[model samples]
Target: MPAPQLVWFRNDLRVADHRALAAAAAAGPVHAVFLKAEAQWAAHGVGANRLAFLERNLRALAAALGVLGIPFTVLEAPRFRDAPGTLLPWAQAQGATALHFNDEYPLNERRRDDAVARAFAQAGVAVHRYTDSVIAAPGTLKTGQGGPYTVFTPFKRRWLATLDLSSAAPLAPPDPQGPVRPLGPALEEAMTLAGAAASAVPAKLWPGGEGEAHRRLTEFLAEAALRYDSQRDFPAVTGTSTLSPYLSLGVLSPRQVLSALLAAFPDALEGSGGPSIWLSELIWREFYRHVVAAFDHVSKGEAFRPAFADLPWRQDPEGLAAWKAGRTGLPLVDAGMRELAATGWMHNRVRMAVAMFLTKNLLIDWHLGEAHFMDQLVDGDFAANNGGWQWSAATGTDAAPYFRVFNPVTQSQRFDPEGHYLRRWVPELAGLDARSIHEPWRYAGGPKAYPKPLVDLKASRERAIAHFKAHAAG
Candidate 1:
């Protein structure tokens, strides 16, 4: 009997452009398994929306693997601690001689992988780990002094300089090896943990499959890439790529994205325009991953800047609840939150505005907003969510300057100037003109159904700045 190699699928769900799966398939006959870590995800605050997206992607993945003559099994472990014990028996039973998987950079994920690697080693099953998620894995680049660059600019420079597009091109899916017997019953219980299948985001908006991911990328580049830089800030324009959910769930690889970009704009790496600007966004994603891997505290729920960790956060449950429920009465903030509630996603520009209101305007804890986003966003990944919240709150590495708080009204007026986004999400204010929609309270016949501003914006902004200044002085 051939000693079949097992491809342990985690976040990297798709077979196309998959490093581990390709390598394993090239080696010999291959088997694949996805372990559902329910308790672990719950502890990590995995929300219904994200769970539903992941489940859909997994089903798509299983079907993809089935066509390639690889049996795809779904295993269950209540927690990361139970993973090795739960998975090893299955691997041994399948006549597995080796295991392959991709790396996830978070601290807990690293520890879990370490534990699993140890168990596999003791069982004489070789384990191989590939860095497939990010363009560059953490710890690969450094500053002149040999430390990780804390800022994004220098890191991006180094990233662009070091990248070799030829070598980084995406791999083709494995050749079909004829039909194989199906694995056991599909694991539905673990897939629908938060009942995320019932999400308000139109199910049609996201169709799970590698083919669908590529289709979205092609559509975005063809239609929106040229205007991405100018229109990305405006929530009303669909200028941004909605490929984040696919990227987060590993239905698409960064290499695949880069390849497509290079094909569309050959000079993109050295030129400036929509393609370059969008590429920078990808680099930012890389930067956050590097931050989490290089600085462990960010993963531990502590502020990147230690001084800000002790900064007083107001315990205003009412205000916090209002923000979460999209009743803050600030149009931009409310729209973003409502969009998040209605769909498992929000536009990036509005995400910044909403986070700033929660952390600075209301002076609520950044952790609260961070957890809420993780629980709500379909594309929520720890590095991006934590980095974004901390950046908005001015508490993380390379964060916004303490004094540069975002004004919700300004954000609304600037981004949704026509009130298109705001009106769509906050329908009660739909009657107001574009100019007045941003600040409905000031309108002659304000939306009576809408609540008043939760707190005076200017007063709250000043309070937050003063609080930070006082901490610095102390």
Candidate 2:
């Protein structure tokens, strides 16, 4: 029998510098397969919007694999209940000797990988797991005492100091055209949506596939990197690198993003401009991944810092509806929420603001808000969403202090000063001038149909502060 290697496709789906695929294809003939864990994705509340986008991305990947003369197979594995046992028999029939794949970090995924490793070992198959998720894997960075970092600032500082230019360099896209043995069945054009799929995606919402990802990287490098700092804060402006969706789906690797960023602005990585700040945000992603790895409890919904477990939170349903539907009555909050509802995405600056409104201003549970974000955000990742929500609520490690509540009105006047974003989502406010738009209630007429502020900002901030302070004192 010819030596065969099985490449299991996970989040790291692209071929650019894919260490696992490169290694496996080097050894012998390659068989690439993707496990469609429908039950697991559904159970985790993976919204139709995200699933639909995923399907489009997978189609693009399948096409790319075929051009390289590799057989691509997508097998249905509902949930991870019998993954290892189920997969082993299938692999055995194919007469595979070695299993090659990248690592997964989420709680359930980690468990699934462990079981698969054991099963493969029992079958006398070597399972080789490589790192393609982040720039540096978790536990690679640590304090002098060898303890996991509870603070982001110090961790980021050390991370910047340890940056290696070699790994951050650009990688060429995969060349699949090579002499190889026939492996598995080729893809069929008729293979389409799995189930009751949602309506077609908006033309301008986002572009899918590795090709688009590379195109976006080139365009952003040429245009947006220069003004990434001054313009990213404005929701109405197209200043930010809107690469989160591609990154979250693993259509594009962080390695590729960093390489492009560094090439565009070599000085910006260390300077005081947009590229530097943008790089900082990327570092934030790395920091949260490390936090999740170090504090396993975070994966299971326990506070990263346990003292925050008792933070008082109102799990109100009606309030949640208002928040999710963009009818929260605060223009900025409503605009941010509406953007999420209509497009399945939101601006980053507004993301933090709205998250704080729900967790701090409304005194609602952060997890509830986090869940809603996951349901809405096209780029949502469990670790990043949880880290952000818990941070906004002042419950996670190095969380935002309870005292620093963002004044909604002040935030609007500062960020969306012209009310352009507000006008786009909440069109009723479009007729109002910028001044009246941010605080509609301040006007005597106050746009005819829009609702007034649902909860008083000052009073809510006071209550949230008192609650956190009293809990701390007790």
Candidate 3:
């Protein structure tokens, strides 16, 4: 019998289109290991909702691996520092001669992988890493000056021009090694030790597994892709594909998504309508991931653009608390926060509104809002969350201009015109008419249960702009 090759599962958990898993299976008999570094994740502000989602996906990965005759083990590392010590002995015990894994680009994860590589080298075990998480890996796209592209538009142009279809095509799942294997007890024990619990998000809201991910993708492409540009901003309508959780956790691959999209709409890349816009959104995801890899400061919680770093963010704890509790009294912002609290997800349009409300309107620090989202969001990916909050705060690459503040009332009137989205989340204002629901403060005999607007929107916007201007001048 040939020596086994151990496949280390990280963010990329699915069986199909998994380069590391395919490589491992081809090398020899494959075994899989997932290091449960829950403590490290918790320290990084990862909340119960995301951890629960991860646990569910881990279980799904184990089941899928079992069908391919690969034994899956869950090891309780608790921290990245413990990973090498925990995994080395397991590999030696299983007589595994090589280890395979897809690369994770965040600073801490990169350091951890490097340490594991060094340890494996000393132990005479080969370590093979593959890029499975992104369509274009970081450092692959560069400017004419031979540096990483900071701006998005030029980077996107290069990405589209330089994309090699042959290499970007998704890999098929590896052939089964032998008969199916029964899952061992380590997985359950590791889950318990890692403190996996019931998620705040409902299971029906986000079903685990690759099959569920693909089903959603197919349905979204078939039904909504064409109208995505038209309906995506409306919170009440299911215009956007609710596949972020799957994409964040790697339950589905970008290649699979792209292939499916092209199969449905051949001119997806070139068209001026919905398909192209949706593709731009996907490119935005890649751009953030690349940003994380290229710029170390963003991953370290520093602003991408240094000019706005010292914009004198306020320390309004009361305002921050209200924002978190979804009682900021601004209907749209409050609704968005409430939606996040209830489902561990919020509409992208509302995410911007709430973030801008916190940072610009209330004068609270963007860091507070960023941490709050990381602690509440089920689809909380560090790169995306960090990139988004910074963008709203006008402190990131291709950020909203400092003078630009999203008027929550105007936004509510435009997007949730009939108040369907507002009423669904903020039931206290349900009886108010569409016009009044947006700005109940202006109407007489408004709901007494709903609080007044937290701040004068116009005054706050002017204040934020003045502050940024003064800071820039100084």
Error of 1 at 249 (Å): 0.8
Candidate 1 deviant stretches above 4 angstroms? 180-200
Which window of 10 residues has the lowest lDDT sum in candidate 3?
A: 189-198
Provide the overall lDDT of each model, using Cα atoms, as 2-decimal numbers.
0.89, 0.81, 0.89
Error of 3 at 369 (Å): 0.8
lDDT of 2 at 317: 85
Clashes of 3: 0
Q: By TM-score, is 1 or 2 better?
A: 1
Q: Over the stretch 1-474, how does candidate 3's per-residue lDDT look in tens digits? A: 888999999889899999999888888888888888978998899887888788788888888988988888888888999989998889999888999999988899998999999998899999999988999999999999999887889988998898777787888888888898777776655655344464567867777899999999999998999999999999999999999999999999988888888888889877878888898888899999999999998888888888877778888888899999989889999999999989999999999999999989988889999999988887899989998998999989889988899999999999999999999999999999888999988998468998888899999999999988888778
- Poorly placed runs, candidate 3 (over 4 Å): 193-195
Instruction: Tell me how candidate 1 scores on lDDT.
Output: 0.89
**lDDT string, candidate 2, 1-474, tens digits:** 476789898887687767788788878878888888888887776776677677778777776777677777877778887689778888898899999998878788889999999999999998999877788778888898999788988998888888787866546644664554333344443235463176244625776688888888888878877788888888999887788888888899888888878877888667988888888888888888888877888988876766678776887888888988888889999999888877778898888899899988888888888888877677878778888888888888788887888887889899988999899999989899989998899899597789888798999999989988888777
TM-score: the better of candidates 2 and 3: 3
Q: How high is the lDDT of residue 340 in model 1?
A: 94
Residue 431, candidate 1: C-alpha displacement in angstroms:
0.6
For model 1, give the 10-residue run with minimal summed lDDT. 183-192
Q: How accurate is candidate 3 locally (lDDT)?
A: 0.89
